[model samples]
Target chain A: MNNPASKRKPYQRELPVDWWLKHAFYTKYMIREGTSIAITIYSCILAWGLLRLSQGPEAWQGWLDALQHPIAILFHIIALGLALYHTVTWFDLAPKAADIWLKGKKLDDKFIVIGHYAGFVLASLAALIIITL
Target chain B: MSHTDSTKLKRSHEPVFWGLFGAGGMLTAFLTPVMILITGILVPLAIISPEALSYERVHGFATSWYGAAILLVLIALPLWHTLHRIFHGLHDIGVKRGRDWQQVICYGAAFAVSVFVFTLLLQML
Candidate 1:
């Protein structure tokens, strides 16, 4: 039997799978997802370094030698790009996850975003100077 | 407008929720460039720096208070935000019933990761 209900639009229409991918949120989500994969791979590289270190100086040097290969360096660059995307997106979400209120007024999200970026810059600079010298 | 129309209007426009979502998006946009700069400059430097190649040096950087702070913020916020987006996405895709389960998994994973990272940081310290 043909049901009128089947032809009528449902009260709650489910969005297509590609709907999420079309929005800005989806772009951000894809970036984050990519970063997660990159992070996992980078972590394994680190774990390998730890193992090599535990082995001895010669083994550690060998690990370093492997890292110096062109393909390895390329992977590192890609991983860094993904990681940076992840970091920035994270700070962007900070103000949303926790709201800031001062004297019964809510602070702007831009302020929080700028503040975190400033902090990160200053901190990185401090680390760079310390390490360089 | 009729009373029914007014009610519909009021329900459609939730200022607080939109404000929060917009604020979050804006905040992320502002921070994106600086993060790019930091990673861009540092990763290259890291490649050249012999010390950067060392596990001790890399781990030391990772485990430092500043490093720990960066990692914590970097991991936490995006994960939380993405999870939030994912929840809405799921709802949009007709998965309306299991939102509580989604919240549990999202928040629970966030908490677990935070604890794990903090524990590692403490150990390093």
Candidate 2:
């Protein structure tokens, strides 16, 4: 008699290598993956802030001075761009990731995505106002 | 009879899995803003306040029980969320073999990094 375990079928059948690449959601996933890398790099800036604090006033001042340089500003701008992209994609995917159920009805993904974006914009505006004041 | 029954069971459960994944994504979206607000306020305050900018000062704050708790939550949650997202992404991209092993690695790395960061924060405090 044949071994039943060995005779069992594989969990997944073979498919084309490019199958994922052809799907739209796969493209979104790639974009999000890239954004995650940018976010990781951006974290280094915060690490630097922590390092400067630990080093005393002179070191902290030096870090601030370097931050004022044009090249540094440019790097920051690029990082900001990456961060913004990450934020947008993250919010966009949020609805797809979590289905909001109220009572027996599921809330629409678009509503959730849009609401998050609105909150982001309002909070950013508030922060800007507070900082400028 | 066996093959047909198995296929039917798999089809029935697929929707449930999709629904759960969708719910997780939405919750992350909603929480992202609060995270931004905290970081935005804290970073600028840390920058502008000379005392807060000092290692000694920041360390003082971080060493406090409150600071340690905040640091722990801030670092851990985002990393965990991102790791989950990355796992799903890898699976989506057809990296199906040894997926369990991949998940273990992702979670382990996130935990290790969070611990390292937390340790650094504590040391400074």
Candidate 3:
């Protein structure tokens, strides 16, 4: 057991810490992944809001009032930008993952992308309208 | 190594998490921006009336079954996608220790929050 055959160290090259910083593609990919942090925090904020809501009106209203702060507004703006970036990247990859055949012809990727944008627009409009109603 | 092993392969739970990741990614792509715009931007800026998100109105929405479902999906589903990304992102950034624990903590956080939100919604209803 002390001399296991697979225990030998392999000659693996050390990667530079900032390897992702060296290329535009890698940088964008890192930023895309980084959006998860913002989204996670935003979700936590909402979760906190729900908790406050559960406590009663004063607590809930306090939560709302807190959102009006400058820092919260800035964070939201940043989060919104990141979310849009996520949307663009996600839709770009969508067509590659989905395959549809129609009348002995495969659907074009452009159409799939366009359809996604249309759905996005419509969904946003629907949410906005619903909230205000 | 013994050659007398069972022929069947051990199953991985990847597909379940992958499905959640896909669904969450789709939802985040389509709806998250507008949600932030409304909740964080318009409402706080008073471009939309505060009453639009007033506690009374929101509470009314939360008490309904459909509303509870929407809230659950919106709050919980995205964590699956984000945490999945975060788990992999840690690898990208070179924190290479304890991969198994990293995965556990990432997904565990998502699952914990999901249950937290679910319980809150259930209680409210």
Q: In angstroms, give how far residue A35 of model 3 lies from its true place.
A: 0.9
Q: Which candidate wins on DockQ? A: 3
Pick by TM-score: which candidate is best? 3
Between the candidate structures 1 and 3, which one is better when assessed by lDDT?
3
| Per-residue accuracy of model 1 over B11-52 as CA lDDT, tens digit each | 453364355435434433344333333333444445336664
Index of the highest-lDDT prediction = 3
- The DockQ scores of all candidates, in the order shown, are 0.11, 0.17, 0.89
Candidate 3 segments whose C-alpha is farther than 4 A from its true place: A1-7, B1-5
TM-score of chain B of each: 0.57, 0.57, 0.94
What CAPRI class is candidate 1?
incorrect
Candidate 1, residue B66: lDDT: 90
Angstrom error of the Cα, residue A27, model 2: value is: 1.6
What's the iRMSD of model 1?
6.3
| Count: clashes, candidate 1 | 1
Candidate 3 lDDT over residue span A44-93, tens digit each: 99999999999999999999999999999999999999999999999999
Clashes of each: 1, 11, 0
Residue range A11-123, candidate 1, lDDT tens digits: 65556767757889876776665554455444345445545555556786787777667677677678667666766877877788769999999998999888977876776
